[model samples]
Target: MNLKGIHHVSAITANAQKNYDFYTSVMGMRLVKKTVNQDSPSMYHLFYADAQGSPGTDFTFFEIPGAGHTYPGNQSISTTSLRVKDDAALHFWKDRFTEHHVDHDPIVELIGKATLSFRDPEGQRLMLISDEYNQGVEPGIPWSQRTIPAEFGIIGLGPVFLTVADITSTKKVLTEILSFKEISEVDHFKLFETGKGGSGAQVALIEDSEAKRERPGRGSVHHVAFRVADETELEFWKNRIEDSGMPNSGIVDRYYFKSLYFREPNHILFELATDGPGFTADEEFDELGKNLALPPFLEKDRTHIEAQLKPLQSSKE
Candidate 1:
């Protein structure tokens, strides 16, 4: 089975309104869905993506106000890179971040590509990588209400960087179980790609055995999901992972998609998710993220869920 690419990256946020404004206004992404965390319905789980909420386009956050800061090191996904069109688009983003007073690093080259690194309000590490070779291949669906021009919009996810203690066992899990092929190595990072090796197909493993282990809290990544074609593929992977002695959460119906979650050798949570029954399953394409939608099982407790979540103000507000 071929694991297509990154399905989504889920991180933590301290303030829902601030996260909403930064992603929708400054970053030029579409807030595709608004829902509560399935396991804990009290917290808000927000989804941001391209217009259609495509598989690789999603970047989500869970609001946890008092959750302490993330200690970045081994066994954690430290950065989520978004793919932009080219170097010119990177320049545009750099200017935009400066104008908005966003905390960011100067543009740097990694793996022979121009990258603009930045952080959200909650200190979640993020980057914009200019895919010069694959320019315009995965263009973002622009939101008409976006402040930034459509041409410079963030297209989709790029390489997700995982800070690992070592690459030996992780490499086996990636290549043998997850279908990733080692593409290259730069500095201390070993790069792996799933499909044809472009944007949305990469995962970089940075080895630092002495680094401190990350504590999951605000500004930390909760999990990273990889895409499968359908339910059959998802089940196949679940069986394979189980047979290989890895612990998994089994198949879960997530309303929008079917998910099977497991921890890799480094203890980073990995999910195998399907591509069908997208964001439009519950809400219309035009009205997505406008209402707080919940799964059928949680519908009875909507009042309690809504009461626990703070009112999220969109950029337009």
Candidate 2:
């Protein structure tokens, strides 16, 4: 049961319309799904991904109005990184950000790859890394109406950075349980790789004992999901996690994929999700993200859910 890489990274946003605009128009990703959060039906849960809404390409957000700002500290996902074609793609994004008046940092070299760091409208940290090494790994499906061309468009997710208060226990869960191999270390940052060790396969842990713990709110990563091939693989992880004394949300049918959520030693939320039964399950391939989608369980309350959600404008509009 080998975990592939990231399935998706979910965050929180205070303003649904602003979040929709930045991810769809500015970032050039397709609004793969428009739905409401299962637990909190009044809040919108938006999914943005590649044209096909591939597993590793999803970056989601939950609308949580009036949520507090994220506290900068250890024990949280500090940044979510996306993979771009190469250095040229990074330059293209740089110019795009400048033209749109989006504040971003200059491209810098990290882990021997060109990286461009930036923030969303809500100040959630994001980065783009050159993926020349993993060009053909899984070049994501390009949205037809994308502002950026397919060649220089963003690929799947790249390495995600987690700030941990202590590396000892966290390292144990990552290596022994999750099957991550420690590839390298730079100063206090340790790099771990799963599967093929490029693009979405990497995760970086920054040891920062002196830093404070994080508070969940808008602009904070809610959870980071990792990919499992299918239900069999997901079950393997569920058992492994439970047997190892880790508490998990056992076997949840999330419509698009089955998932099991567990918190690591540092309290960072992690999810093991299946790869299939993708976004196309509830909607047609060409009509995805065109209307409100609800799981069968939530279908009965569709009218109420739609009434609670704010009307969002898509880039296609």
Candidate 3:
């Protein structure tokens, strides 16, 4: 069984309201889900993605009130990349960021792709990578209703960056257990890709042995998930990961898709997720994320869940 590409990247946020504002109003991504974190029903878990909330486009967050600041270091999912249409789109974002006062750097070339690095208000590290010449995994369609033009809109997630203390052990887990192939390495970073290699199916690794381990808080990535075709394949991965002696969360019914989570050698969380029965499973195509949604298991506690969350939208926009 081959892992397709990045499924989603979940992160942390201290304030859900501000997170919603920045992503929807600034980043131009659609809020596809405004539900509570299933594992911890008291706080909100938001999902931002393309028009359909496609598998490869999902960027989610779990709100933790008064979450502390993140101390960036090794053994962390250092940076998350968002894919744009081309190099021109990369510059358009630079100009847009200036208008909105978003913290970002000038465009620079990385492994032949134009890249722009930026940070959110909470100090979340992010990059916008051009997919102009991408020939591997396809990107998702950005939300058409967004203020940003479709041509320059973010299409999907790109290579996830990992900073680890032990490059040898992390490389073994990736190349051997996860089946990633090294495509290139430059300076201090090494690029690995799985399945059909390209910007969409890649992970960039940076070994920083001198840095201390990351103190995760608001703005830190929670985990990165890779795509599996379906539950059958996910089951196969469960056994394979188990055989490799890496402890994993066995098959979990996430309602939208099946999932099993595990951490690689560097203590970075990784999840294997299916691609079917996605965001539209419970909500209508046009009505997604308008109201709070709960899974079948959490339906019984709807009243309590609603009471805990501050209303994401004052009224339907």
Candidate 4:
């Protein structure tokens, strides 16, 4: 099965409004979509990406609305890395950071690449890698039209390492249910790859004996969304996961897409998301990210929701 790429990466955040500001104003990503968490409607579920909310380009936030924080550890968890186009864009991002008064560490080398590490308003650890080695032609359109030259854009997603208390169960699930092949194992880390390219082949899980289960709060990964071909492919995954006796929440409408959610042995949330009816579903190419869009269920309540929402800061350059 050929997986397309990452549909999106969802993370928990402390404050909805502050994250909204940091992602849009500081990071220069457009707030392509904003809506309340369907399960927890009191808090906002904000999405930041290139103008049109394209897959792989997206980093979403599920606001915790004044919750306590989550600490980082090596229990199948690590920093979230966003791949930038090249080193020059790293300079551009540096300048932008200085101009906007956003703080970031000086560029450093990590796993043989130049990376800039930083935190969002809620302190989620994020790193941007300025390397696109062996990247292919861009297929999906950019959600944001902010002129991300091919060399400086986020071409690939870095491997997400997990920390599981026991690697045996999760390992079985990955190999049998998810079809991941065990690549190699090192100290406190086990790597698995799909032998595919783009975003599909880039997921890794790590197990640590001393790892403790941590709750998802601000600054922690809410979920890692994997790609599926379409509804048919989604059904295949659903059946596979169910057959494996892993608890799974079937399909749920996510407005722009559909998804199924489950938790691995490490307790990190995983989402199986589709790749269709993208940003163009609600907005036109020319008008992407120009305004807030509400799903059909929330359209009637738009006025009330809009009234409760604070004004957005302008990011026009």
Candidate 5:
């Protein structure tokens, strides 16, 4: 079955508070959820996204303190690209960056579009492009404290690259199981497409022999999720991942979506997520990103969980 699209991308960060400020304040995304990392409750799992926390709109990060710095290699590949409304919007961002004194370079042409590149507080590379064909998405509340205008907020995440030592296994899973098609290969980099012509999903697999293993910490991407149509297709993917001898986490409800996780040889976490029971599941449209939201499974532990959390708020610096 063809996957629907991307779900959300998760990453690891050093300081939860700093990450929160950058994603919400600087980027203008809504802090859809303020919950602890399920595996490590001490750290947070901060989710940043557009209105309704739509799939492909989310960029999540976890705070794991004291994690050593990873050597950025050609294989340490992770890029968070965003789709914009038009080239005029790109000009708007250029002026916004200049007005806010944010460090950035002039727009660069790639994939036949003018794009601007910058980095987040955690050093994750970010790019923005005004591609009119992307899905129409509503923006969340205008973060009044943002350095940039809310009208030009990021719509959704785009092609995220993965630096892997070997692309064979991961490539197999992506093509054979996930139904991704190889679009092109340039300079030893393989690009795969998983969505429709324009608004679909894309990934670049860069093979690097000396690429160091990613140590989950600040600035590290947590995982990239592939979208499934519904629960039925999610089950199909479960059997497919298992049939291929890749160990996977069985279907787990994530409130906004259900997810299954696995790791490729290079150790980048990969998630197969279903899109449904969206951001509105636990929040009102007008009041999203205003409070903490707990998954149904974690609702009973809210009091205990809140106590364990380091008081944090998504704010602009």
Candidate 6:
């Protein structure tokens, strides 16, 4: 079975409140899920996405107070891109970034599309790529209450950029282990595409054999998860990864979706996750991101968990 496009990209945030404000107020994305990290219930794991928290639209973060600044280098998910409607949207964002004092670069053509690179307050490397006439995977609609005009609003995620030491090892895993195909190359960067290839289903590899490994902290991406159709497909992927002799976390119950996490040859974390039983699983659609949501397994520890977390309130709440 073929994998779908990206499911979500999870990064680190030292201050949940500032992260919330920048994404919701400045970037104009909707805060779709307000939950705790299942692995570490004391910290927040916030999810931002399109109107209904669609799979490919998810951009999430895990809070870690006092996290140090990330030192950019190799073997890292260096940059994350958000999908905008067209070239005009890219210009719209440039203007908006100026208005909000958001750090950004002028729009330019990259990998066959117009892109505008920018960074969040915490120095997260981000870009806005236009999906004008995009015909691969479907993009989610903008959130209803977003102050930014719906036409110029951000949609789903675009191509994720990976900076690695050696492209050979990572490329093998991407092609043989996973199903991505090498589509194009520009200097040190090679572009790969998976199911229904487009901006939404691509990853760019930037090779720097001499660079040091990245020091991940605040603003560093923790992992990139690709979308699988369902639990059955996720199980199938687990078997394939195991057969290929790659050590993996097999068939994890993520509450919202089932997942199988594995690290590629370059040590970049990759997760295969299902697309269903989403944020709506524990809360109503309109009520999403409004309250602290705990899965059934974590329900018993809700009191303790609540006590440990600092309040991360937002307008959605």
Residue by residue across 1-317, what tens digits does model 4's lDDT show?
64455567888877666776676545656676766677755567777776446676678887776677786664535667676666776777776667766668898765445778777766787877765452432423333335334445544355565767777877887777777777666544566665354322455556567855665568888777877767888888888889888899999887788889998766667888887777678877666655767778888887887776665565543
Query: What number of backbone clashes does candidate 1 have, counting pairs of residues 3 or more apart or in separate chains?
Result: 0
lDDT, candidate 5, 1-317, per-residue tens: 67766677887788888788767766667787777677666667888887557777788887878766644654344666776666777888888777766667898766545778876766776788666544423322333434555566677776777777778877887898788888788656687777663433877787777756655446667678877878898899899888888898899887678889987666777888887877788888777766767777777888888887778853745
Candidates sorted by lDDT, best first: 6, 3, 2, 1, 5, 4
- Local accuracy of candidate 2 as per-residue lDDT tens digits, 1-317: 56888899999999989999888888888888998888888998999988789988999999998998887888999999998888899999999999888879999988768999998877899999997766324657656554788877767888889999988888999899999899888745788888766778778988899988988788999999999999999989988988899888999999899999989989999998999899988899888888999999999998888888878875642
Which should have the higher TM-score, number 3 or number 5? 3
**Of 2 and 3, which scores higher on lDDT?**
3
lDDT of each residue in 1-317, candidate 1, tens digit only: 67888999999988888889888888878899899889988888999998778889899999887789787778999899998878898899889899988899999998768999998877889999987876322545655544677678777899899988877989999998888999889867888888656768789988889988888878899999998989999999999998899988999999899999998888999998999888888888889999999988999998888898888875862
TM-score per candidate, in order? 0.96, 0.96, 0.97, 0.84, 0.87, 0.98
lDDT of 6 by residue, 273-296 (tens): 999889999899999998999989
The CA lDDT at 260 in model 1 is 98
> Which is the leading candidate under lDDT?
6
Error of 5 at 211 (Å): 3.6
Model 1 CA lDDT for position 144:
54
Compared with the true structure, the alpha-carbon lDDT of candidate 6 equals 0.91
Which 10-residue span in candidate 1 carries the lowest summed lDDT? 135-144
Instruction: Tell me the spans in candidate 6 whose CA falls farther than 4 Å from its real position.
Output: none
Runs with alpha carbons beyond 4 Å of true place in candidate 5: 74-77, 132-151, 186-188, 197-200
Score candidate 6 by TM-score against the native: 0.98
C-alpha lDDT values of all predictions? 0.86, 0.87, 0.90, 0.67, 0.72, 0.91
What's the C-alpha lDDT at position 73 in model 3? 98
Task: Look at candidate 6 and give me any clashing residue pairs.
Answer: none
